[model samples]
Target: MGGSRHVATSSTHPGDLHIPGSHRFYCTAPCLSWRGGVGMRGSVPPPLIPVSPSSLLQPEPLLLAPSGTSRPAGSHRALRGSLERESFKPSSQPEEPKHNRRQPSPCPRSVVEAAKAHPTFGELFQFATPVLMWDQHFSPETWNRLKERHVPYGWQGLSHAAVSSTLRLLNASANRHLFDRRRFPGGCVRCAVVGNGGILNGSRQGEAIDAHDLVFRLNGAVIRGFEEDVGTKISFYGFTVNTMKNSLIAYEEYGFTQIPQAEDLKYIFIPSDVRDYIMLRSAIQGSPVPEGSDKGDEPRKYFGPEASAEKFKLLHPDFLHYLTARFLRSELLNMQYGHLYMPSTGALMLLTALHTCDQVSAYGFITANYEQFSDHYYEVEKKPLVFYANHDMLLEAELWRSLHQAGIMELYQRFQLENALHSAITPQPKRLAPGQDKWEESLAWRRNGLN
Candidate 1:
């Protein structure tokens, strides 16, 4: 970081930050309600979401049986994003997006002080007892105990063999921290978690995104023709097996025909369904999927044939539970539809970065003005963002907004030029809560010092 460079603040809101002289930086912000299409849990399914197989979610409704009864056919899988379209023809390359933005040198960030300054971070951090589950943590006792809980926390309906085998194979790799601290040695390691929000459509943030030490991308991350906006580098790709396949099927027409593959790129599996464990096992063994919805599916088609266990990571169910319980505890959890709730894939990845990286920037994620743009920036046609019953995206938005205000993370938000300029010229300062004043005062100090 250059001494001359100073932290910038958004005139419209205290949470959003603008890097002085930098190409607008931050990654991911799209909370699509694909969860509405997920099979309802702990009860009967809801009315269909009017989605087709071609949609991002295939819509398989699950019906859980009584404690003593045999599980329903669909009960085996925790999630229902399995059905995919047969006409999955890849779309012609989308028109190449254009860019004229220049990137400034990197600005440093630290989550330590920022998280401490936050009102709820201490409480939330307590729940992160174990963020990633590796072989060393797996045991018959652990499995039996976890099995008592529901999905994303326990393996209730999943196979003991499948779970054990997967954990065993993760003996050495994919079970530890995301990256080596030795890589940065003694510096603030910055990360960018890119999303599929429409805000990044023309943001021209590609260069700035690649500037981070690590970049995380999730579901339907269409990058081919949009490199000018989302960047080409992917140090990590986060998704469930369902999402990876679903994105390929549902987004092929948008030019996302394949998942990103590289020798160094690691895959983070959320373990949302049995398909993820099965697929991960197969991928690590260099074999075809043996059973389940993706039976016979060749791992080579996705991960390169040489891909090893070192290239995959399985997020701990404990972490997922902690995130839901502590951070984005949506109201839907109390409803009949609550069982279907899970944080969007993007939310999971961004949170993962926050815990692992010194600093995180969320790009293309949902903002207050989400209605102003389509669901996805790369959609050939403009499709309004759908609010499905499966995910309470609005709640996630509040968390992101608060995290921004707390200075725990930087979420790049775009306001209309006229409005931004207007706010800049005639600011209407809101009554902030206690401790929030520190954020504003800190920004002011930096801005004044830079001047």
Candidate 2:
């Protein structure tokens, strides 16, 4: 009689309570809170019937049998009305963008310049002689057996098929570095792998030269007043014995009396002759230059004790296959190079850089309007981009354009970037030496497909 609670009927209102079959107990004060444990001692009452609004109010004490089972101290299911109304569902996740790829560490201008003061083994390895090989891929055994193992990492002992696939991936990844694709967040890093082409002289790209992250030059490419057209920075310089000599002799009038001096510019040697190998080996051992009749006077000075020839990086053979398989199609490969067989030197240099640099932007290369410039920057006359028996220029151009379209490279057009760098202008007829004319004739014959 002291404290028994009862509910009479069930109602939709929050304050109205029900206890089924007992006497009516209308809740008129406020909402009620059920707390503490309720023991299940007696049976529950019958189901309650809802009262209509017209029914009269009753105040009878309803019997409230503690029907709730007593759960263990921590095992109670405490369900709040507010919590029960909220629906639970998993949320959708966002997709990551493709541009989030590997990033290369940026080498600052100051650091790059600082590296120039000390000439490493690369600088000392002055001789670049071309090493020619047939289409036959080298076996892993063959590479391991070589006197000096020059293959890049991860390329040793791979089967031809495996090597083919791996190089394809590498080439694909490298091509991604050549453009402004979403795969490369760093945007395009244009590199002008400038050859000693006389064609660049009157092309009018002097002042409007393309802006790129790096520039590679070879041999005797003199960029004095044409700095605007060719940019002032010399990032990478490549050389071979014959090519470097040719550059010096050919471009001497183009302000190339001495090699372009840069604090951080790297000198890359292209081995094209057997003598170059001997000279380099001697230089590495700090020995005197070999005694050959053709050897220059006082060759010992070229390979002094300070020379470090072994540090120079050589191109991996797999890299050549990667290039040949992708760009140099079979038809172009069969294109002969005079009495000997080889790809264009400029093409080879640029291709090597494509694989080496993390990002590449090309400037001062042949374009659709290649007819607009002299054969070389220091040319006395405007010369057509003459095809030679020594190399295939048209095929190279086609490859460049294809790579550009595939987002693999950036080719600076002759007229497009003229105002960006220092350049010169002239109009002259095409000319060639007596011995070189034969090469042009052979080039024309190849163009006509004589064989």
Candidate 3:
């Protein structure tokens, strides 16, 4: 009767017992097995039961619900506990072994030796007793000197904080391959400074221009359809922020929809205003131009998406001051438009190349016979070149001629053609009233955006 009663109870609660030759039933609560063991239903053959206090304190076995059935409230807590245990468990897999990474290739030994052997003007200046450094980095003393001596016209008043921030940001940018020895392995870097002057219109000097180790081009350098005359190679492009923006605005019709973006090409930023520093910082950071007259301006729109810190070079204000004090100072310094006067982009590039390269050849630059040709080589019509108070063309022309005579640089000269053309087109000087030489008219025209 007792055995029959146990069988009846097991039959009533099938989950408490494992029925032979049938699928097992799982239990939500602890159940007594047929052999007096305590465990979840359908685990395995019945085992011996534990009666110690330690056994009672042990955690309960996790309960899993059958398919299509709901789990009990305690089952949820068990699931969470199981997951926590799994998360805290140590991983058995080993970590990857780290290896030493290779460094970038250094500059060629020969070029380094050559740089040491032939001290450049910049190096000599730096070594002088009263030293004057000429690199892009500026000290506070140098910045103060530049502020006093050099005035960038379009900028707001100069401030130490602003200038310091610009320098700090620039210094934080990736280092450039400045005159890389690997690129100039022969230790004699020849450079071509190509200006946009119309002298290059029929010069047929493309092959000669491309042969140089580096080529510096500035302003409206339209070379797509006119590659035969201007050459396809451009190593460095130099421009002020004002000039670059103006060039894009003014010369979009002449195939200059974008600036040069060759993989190996670099940009030299002429710091003509605080906007330049702002733009440069934004460009390096790959962000929109922050707080300034050029707020919300996208630098990638001008310098392309791949533009990087290493690809942009800023000219130090002190360097500009040194260049002005040494080579390209104009008499306009004393005039009312003195603040507006600076060397043209071409003059700056040519002088920079002269100081950096072993040999430099200038092309399409203003000559004494500039009146014979159009204002720009890409001009479809032979428009007469207009003179402005901002640049001293006459002074630049004399300097070029003198530099050529001294053999410091090879300035492309077509004297016979220039002389003949000048003689044929020379006009009688229009007599102006005393102390009136069309300066005011030019200034007014420039102010009205006619330049």
Report every candidate's CA lDDT: 0.64, 0.39, 0.55
Ranking by lDDT: 1, 3, 2
Residues 217-253 of candidate 3: C-alpha lDDT, one tens digit per residue: 9867889877878898999999876567656655667
Off by over 4 Å in 3: 1-150, 153-156, 172-177, 415-451
- Report the number of the highest-lDDT candidate: 1
Residue 353 of candidate 2: its Cα lDDT?
Answer: 57
Per-residue error for 172 in candidate 1, Å, reads 1.3
Q: How large is the C-alpha RMSD of every model relative to the true structure?
A: 17.6, 37.8, 36.3
Error of 3 at 138 (Å): 4.9
lDDT of 1 by residue, 1-451 (tens): 3455443332211111234444231111111112223321222232322221111111112122223332223321122223222222111111111441212213354675667555546434442346677898797778877776567656878889988889888877546778766677555689999999888888999999999889999878889999999999899999877567657756777898888898889889888777788899999999999998678999988989898888888898777766665555543443344455577788999888887777899998877667656778797666666554445555566567778877889998886565456675675323223343322222233233223
Off by over 4 Å in 1: 1-109, 418-451
- What's the TM-score of each model vs. the native? 0.71, 0.48, 0.62
Candidate 2 C-alpha lDDT tens digits along 187-287: 43445577656545555654444455566776666777766556566766666544554444445566766655544454454444433333444544456
Clashing pairs in 3: none
